[model samples]
Target: MDNIFGDAAERLFAQTCTPDVIRRAEQGQPSGDAWRACEEAGFADALVLEDHGGAGLGLADALPVVVAAGRHLCPYPIAHTLLARAWLSRVQRPQASGAIALAPQGLAIDDGRVAGTNVAWARSADYVLAGIGGQTWLLPMQAARIEPNGVHGSLDGGVSWALADAERIDHVAPLETLAASAYTGLIAGAMDRVLAMTLDYANQRTQFGKPIGRFQAVQQQISEMAEQVWAARMAAQLAFQGEDGLPRPLLAALGKARASQAVPRVADIAHAVHGAIGVTAEHDLQLYTRRLREWRLAAGSESHWHDRIGADALASRSDALTYLRTALYGKETA
Candidate 1:
């Protein structure tokens, strides 16, 4: 499919998410300018309905922006904001301006009170969308007591209120699928950047008066990295190509699993190729690598998704090939 929006988003992110901008944001500085630029460009609301003051794009269309943000390590809650806006629009809730975070775990609503701990990005968000007892809610940030849990590289780490009073709204969309799709895109983008950086370094850096890439050992490593990157990107693409309005959980699980599994290997090879410089904060490689490591655990880990996939396959009594085909193509062959 021709993704014009994806193309546009990629260009916009490339223009604004420069190395200097990323470096500044990584140093605990606010990325207001970057966020404002994305907001002005309509990226922040890309997944919301047009009736709700957004671009009215599908999750597939909006996912490229998430990928681009990942590649640049854009210091914003790109995926969370997209999901929050979509959920709010679906439930006819008034859309709020500024960043929003999604609490995927540790949320409870009782007697008009909300309680959660370790809600991602709650400290910086204007609002939070959480699920409690199979019901969805939109809670204002002020209603919750947020404490900074310190930074984990590019990720916004924080703990939320243990208990707070707030009104709950009804929303039931397959948010986990959306989150998995977006996170898969992020991993794909990070992998892309890391692979590119490694390739460029391998071709340029000389050892023993020859380009390191010319060595068999280095070439083998680069080839493995390239394969992992391709697999992760393709898996993410498959996840984005949902059958209906929602992403296929099986595909999303597989994509997230594959991407998460690829992170450690990709990071190892990328850093190994770049030597000690890749780990330093001064180098751009660490930015993408660190985020890759974190994104691997976010939404769900490889083991989590693997267990889900395995359970589903066993429950359905499908063979390995059948299950793999169904997960990748969303259908069974006669």
Candidate 2:
């Protein structure tokens, strides 16, 4: 129910993360200053508890903050730390404060050689949380390759690395799943921003001596976009609210499902409303919509979530229906 990160996030976004700075970050230029401002904003500490200099908020509380960052396309790793530090708490790494980046393809752990990390953002990360051989590891960033790639996506032209010195840390929960959910939440939030901007454009842009939004066809598109955004928002809320020791896969899948569907719909509406200008870099709408597309397929696509949901449904059958029923009725059945 706590939707705000106080005034910290707002102040940081307004003062430190200006539109120009964000554009630079999105264009693949890493700004240590902006990243540091993010640290100052308490984003890096979202996962770390108060005792460890964090806000001590759980995933539900932190979702909005992550979503806001996604809307702005802020190129910092808030969600990664959220996953890593929360898991590290179990193993007494409660004092950790740094950016974390989850590998989309996962890492491999082998003897004397680290594997399983593909497409990492370790260049900007002070520390790393890695997955290896069904175990989690906290390792120094130097151990990974940090392979250099262009700024085609959000990685910012940074190099990715494999976990060469992935030291297994026992008892720490894996942050991969949580990271997935947060990433999905962020995309969903960005979609909301995109739709709103598109609606505003439709309202203001006049053609044939009338505002485009006054037309029924334009209104229908805007309405559909709104519905999609609302559905994704609900899904994100479900994922956040159900983070009470629940398996991350389920919540993550749900969040991803909602977002993946909503983003494209939102993007289409935005472009349609803005016409030729929407695709231009000059408009901020493109930034949000572009990142929405990138992030939509980054973690997992719609096909991935649908398969996951289908698997869950098949495995539980009536028990799953009971769970759904419980959610509707506010009580779990035996």
Backbone clashes, each candidate = 0, 11
Instruction: Give one digit per residue, the lDDT tens place, for model 2 in 85-132.
Output: 665653565445457766544555545555443344554666666655
The TM-score leader among the candidates is 1
List of clashing residue pairs for candidate 1: none
Candidate 1 runs further than 4 Å off? 108-117, 150-154, 162-165, 243-245, 321-334
| TM match of model 1 to true structure | 0.88
Runs in model 2 deviating more than 4 A are 1-7, 109-124, 142-144, 148-153, 156-164, 243-248, 326-334
Model 1: per-residue Cα lDDT over 1-334, one tens digit each: 2277777777877887787877766565667777788788888888777887888777677767877777876667776787667767777888888887776667765554566645665545667766667876667776666555465544344444434444467656565666777788889988988999999999999999999999999999999999999999887877776632356788888889999999999999999999998888778898888778878887788998889888888887877897777744667666
CA RMSD of each candidate after superposition: 2.8, 3.2
TM-score of each: 0.88, 0.85
> Model 1 scores what on Cα lDDT?
0.76
